[model samples]
Target: MNKLKLSGILAVIALFAMASCTQKKESNSPKNLQIDNKILAQNLAQKFIITDGHIDLPYHLKSMGFLDLKNTPTLVDGIKGDFDFPRAKKGGLDAPFMSIFIPPALQKTGGSKELADSLINMVEHITTSFPNHFGLASSPNDVIKNFKSGKISLPMGMENGSPIEGDINNVKYFFDRGIRYITLTHGKVNEICDSSYDPVRTWNGLSPFGKEVVLEMNKQGIMVDVSHISDSTFYQVMELTDVPCIASHSSVRKFTPGFERNMSDDMIKLLAKKNGVIQINFGSSFLTYKYEKRLKERDSLKRIFMKENNLTGKDSLAKAFNTKWLEENKLYADVEIVADHIDHVVKLTGIDHVGLGSDYDGVGNSLPTGLKDVSGYPNLLEELLNRGYSEEDIEKICYKNVFRVWNAVLDHAGKNN
Candidate 1:
């Protein structure tokens, strides 16, 4: 019984070991790990209250002529923009700061305040029109309350300070009207500050009135947004403001070199030092220089094509040509690059300073591959989990970091008042 029985026992042991090894390998395989991470990411997205620093739904609605109460139902899913009730719910977007965007042209057109008021009114109308689906949030507490009640919070952040209309009192007025943060300027210098996109650099920084506006904003408990302001304006505002400021929809300039619209590495660090968050934008151009370079080339070619064909951009032929070119070129950045921007911020500052601020609707058709709409947030969170981000870190990136700044602004205002 000795040799035969021993060989049989050894074979059984070997078979058991092989089975265990195979099971372990299957569990740890890349495909299984990705699926596990995807599930975890989706759970984290819904478990935590996700607050996107900026979403251009209000402006997008106005442009589409769907800002009226009669057309409000379209926002449930009938519209074409990146944000809608169904998509926001699917993505677990609890609080998305609705951009009350006042185009710079309005600053000269003598109707900045009116346009801002109208946009704010439209947001209010949305909340009223769909009470169960939306609520207006003026503070972090409001967001929390809305989240608990299963309502999406529509906080307001003015894209340009043009609505202040040269009146210091309008700062308080806007705060009362639920403008939580205000980007000093956009695409051009305004009475408040110089825009990064403006070549003129009108004030070289904040105007004398701009400094007053910043202080007024602080006193009113409004977070000053430095997203589109010039570098000089940023530095000056940082020196003047008492509370932490946010770059609501800006990404890191390190990724897209020479794009002042995105914050620099040094700027991110400073923002972190003040306990502020830089919500990373998901636009392809904001994620990498390649996209910007390709965009420039595409624009140049389009101009040449238009000229050669004697067609305007609005012409159907030119539109078709542009669409076809984009389809063939396919230069969009993927979700991984967006995670890279978040990683860059986490490395330069910390996880507390980075948050999501997908410029939906505002970025046109240049959103990154997996982040093409509000519903794609889970994809980014899955990437973050795969890259070794913990649930706590994801929560901070999702909402807590921004809430800290918002609460601080409120506390400062309370003490001064």
Candidate 2:
């Protein structure tokens, strides 16, 4: 009786263990989810608002010496640029913040404000020219309406606060002109704040005037972009800002160590605490240190070759050599690398604090492979989906998080006014 009873008990325990193991394995298995991630990604892209925090459409147009977007041949069809009407439509991109970039050179010399105004005008003209295909989005509600109408929304974000000059009132002025966010500085320290790229940490953070600009931005319902600012500037802005700030197009600094342009782990955590969002940049240099090193090496070699050949930039020899160099040194981190940045943010914080801000049209030729242009968004969405992200999380990444910060800024401004 003892041997029979013991054997029966052992068999039952073994059966229970097998069932538990199977359940545990299936829970962790991506394949067991029985979902076609590709289709899910595509569907989610189409169904959601897909608001990228920054896109350099206005700057791209300005570079062409053409203020026109609809009549611009390159935008009508895909050119060497990373964003265009056709590509955005194909990618299901509904809302993209058209970056009004003011070159830092214009800061000391002045004219930044005028240039910013002109770029904003160009964006408005694009909407007027292609009314059926494009519309201006001044708020989150406008984006939703544009989405309903099957039109792409072109919201504006100024890439440099140089446009504001030293005038605190100009912050509200730009916001009135539909400039929703302002990157306080660019490659150089300005009157507003110290830049990450500049060696001179003039103010050590935000200048006295910069703090005024931040307050005005908050009062006027404009997001304070911290992508190009110094770590001190970021920290100071974080402390001073009443509303959530955004690194409109930055990657995880953990992936690219010492890259001040990317947010650090602690910065990300602090940002999440403030209910802010970090939109992942898809540039190869921003994604991984290894890729960034390769890019630097390639540039160094290219410069050496140019010098050795005595080829000036305008010469045919220089052009040919530059072409050859680009072709040979075109190193792209895959779309997975970009997805990894998104995953890193989500892991550190929650999915609520992360979103897409590809820096498209702004990254030059360093865009990650399979994410070459606006049309490449589905590739990223698919990667996130396959990595076990649900549609809800993807939607948040696409637009909800962006809207949350945007609305918060607006709401904060409303209360102050």
Candidate 3:
């Protein structure tokens, strides 16, 4: 063969060899797992102990105006709400903190304690009504034990501190009642701390009584949740808390600029420094700035529509109008956006400080597209897999990080008490 012809033949052989190697590598990648993403996601979900930092099941049930725990649609099918037994099982969610949410109005009406107690009763009623399916998890050990027995763990976290009724001893009272975490305030300023949503700046950080509450909480082993409090309150709590803290159902503020409801990059870094965790909120508003604006506009329009039509919220006409408006201006985000928030946390801190806290049922109908309910967790796992996260890292994101914080709180309590 001529020299030029021989060189061309050699290059063709090399190209063929390279293509074969590339094909082999592709087949062996994590993307080539058996079956579809749904199955792979299911497998991962089952393989790990998935713990969500917050869920508003108690409030959701209360909003329905009644409770028949065993016979309720929530324990059965739960097509309306974001969480239920069937969906939780399918998603492999082992532990979800049942939010004992106290509305801010209750503070003025003087029933915050009573309302909080009722919700706590409702949570206990679930395990009493269906012993085999669900059980109460008061600690990290309890969660693991429940997971082993193939049952979902219902841990409780109070959404607002108003239930404490300004008494520091109520912190221990709640801790004894299976309340594992407490969001200092809700959407309004309170005695403990100011809320991110409230204009009043209240105590600036923590009130003298709020400082006592923080110490009592830490000594009692309750996780100080910085989800709904103002930025100043978060820093103050971090300063006061001896044990690791958690932003139970919050997303990074980087995505939604000026949204104090979400944690800023500085706060995230500081949280990680305290060995704390920021469980990413899956709500559309928490994930993107653009969607937040759209949600506001939609709400404003809905208000106008209600007034123009003389439709009270109780009227069917108002419900229909609100439904139609949501359908017309759907600003749903993709599940991948949630993964992006996780990525942001992981990049700023590490895999050890990020976890899932979907804010399910609490965000109402504002859930993201692919992650509309409890069953959509696998979609999130599939996204993480696509992003090249290893099984160990995924496990850390699933539960280990939060478990560490939970255990740390317990340990701190042991010493402090």
Q: Which candidate gets the maximum TM-score versus the true structure?
A: 1
Judge candidate 3 at residue 372 and give its lDDT: 84
lDDT of each: 0.91, 0.88, 0.88
Tens digit per residue, CA lDDT, model 2, 25-137: 88757774435676777787788889888898777777876764445544555666888878888788999999999999998788999999889999888788778888999
Q: Per-residue CA lDDT of candidate 1, range 59-178, in tens?
A: 888887765646564677547879888888888899999999989998888899998998999999989878998999988889999999999999999999998999999999999999
Question: Which of candidates 1 and 3 reaches a greater lDDT?
Answer: 1
Q: Per-residue lDDT tens digits of candidate 3, residues 146-241?
A: 999988999999999999998788899999999999999999998888999998997997889989998898999999999999999989888888
Each model's TM-score, in the order given? 0.92, 0.86, 0.88
Q: Model 1 compared with the native: what TM-score?
A: 0.92
lDDT of 1: 0.91
**Candidates' RMSD to native:** 2.5, 5.0, 3.8
Off by over 4 Å in 2: 1-35, 68-71, 77-79, 296-330
In candidate 3 the C-alpha lDDT for residue 141 amounts to 91
